[model samples]
Target: MPGNETTHPLLQRFHEGDPAALGELSDRFSPALMGFAGRLLHEPFLAGDIVQDVYIKLWQRKGEYDSIEGIRKFLFVATRNACINQNEKYRLRQGQPPSSEDADPDEAMRKLILSEYLGLIYQIVAAMPDKLQQVFYLSFEEGLSPEDIAQQLDIPRQTIKNRKVEVYKALREGLKHYKVAMPILLKMLFPH
Candidate 1:
């Protein structure tokens, strides 16, 4: 019962050899993976190849994962490894020594953790109402002040503040399950 509790419908479908399920999983996770790989490798073309390879590897080992979280962990580790391998190869071609700093295990793990947090935040924001989503993006993503957002959206300053409070409440509620992660996220979002 405990084990099955964590089983996702997509994961079950994937285990049954459903190609569409794999595609759906790929669609869900690829953007985050691509962003991670692109930042790690600094080559968009190489990053694309790495993300594709990660999905292929996931499909190849489809039976190994029992939960969506497991699949996500596998994808992150595989993508990171592939990026490191590519960096090593590039270094070899350029006749440069392998950079030790590039292979810091903790750095990769930290990045993976941050990516997961951001992915969860994205999911929460996606489920928000359109007005709240717009306010959140403008205030947080676009770094606009409340006054700026109010001016741009032609709303009152008090209305912008109210919307921001709603956005914060929604985000905090969505993250309530992640007790350990919530504090870190809050600090990052409101470092003031």
Candidate 2:
């Protein structure tokens, strides 16, 4: 339940041709995909269409993903490409110049991944103890230095630092059940 730990097994089931697994995957990722597509297309209905197309492609290319990570990456990448193609068609239809939105595929993927990552982090942080959650929001969301956070909260700088460490430790432990290594998760969470 914590951080999609079952994604691998679900994906494996999907690879084994279980239709229900595909449905589960769709239910899990459709909201995120819709949001990503909507952001790119600026049209809710078209975004839904794009996500539907992505699912159709997934079914067509069944058994292509060997890992949960691969499937996640593929879905976002395909959705982005589809969005770009849609944008190009719209521009041509309107007789307008194509926008630069799709110029960098890598950047788009990064944004999509980061969006999902932060959403997971937010869920985890929200479930944390109030004090620890405060520390987390101050340090990460508010972009405050430890010392600044300490001053703002009237806590010692050392306590603030300790709370930060505790927060990371809790996150690592909570996320470990999801099979994500701490170092990689930390790097993604705190990319600087």
Best by TM-score: 1
**Best lDDT goes to which candidate?**
1
Report RMSD (Å) for each prediction in the order shown.
4.9, 8.4
TM-score of 1: 0.59
List runs of model 1 lying over 4 Å from the truth: 1-7, 102-192
Candidate 2 structure, TM-score to reference: 0.52
Worst ten in a row by lDDT for model 2: 114-123
lDDT (C-alpha) at residue 161 in model 2: 81
lDDT of 1 by residue, 39-151 (tens): 56735479889889889888889899868878877887788778878987888888998866547988767766765666566557666788987887776666788888899
| Total backbone collisions for each predicted model | 0, 0
The global C-alpha lDDT for each of the candidates, from Candidate 1 onward, is: 0.76, 0.72
TM-score of each: 0.59, 0.52
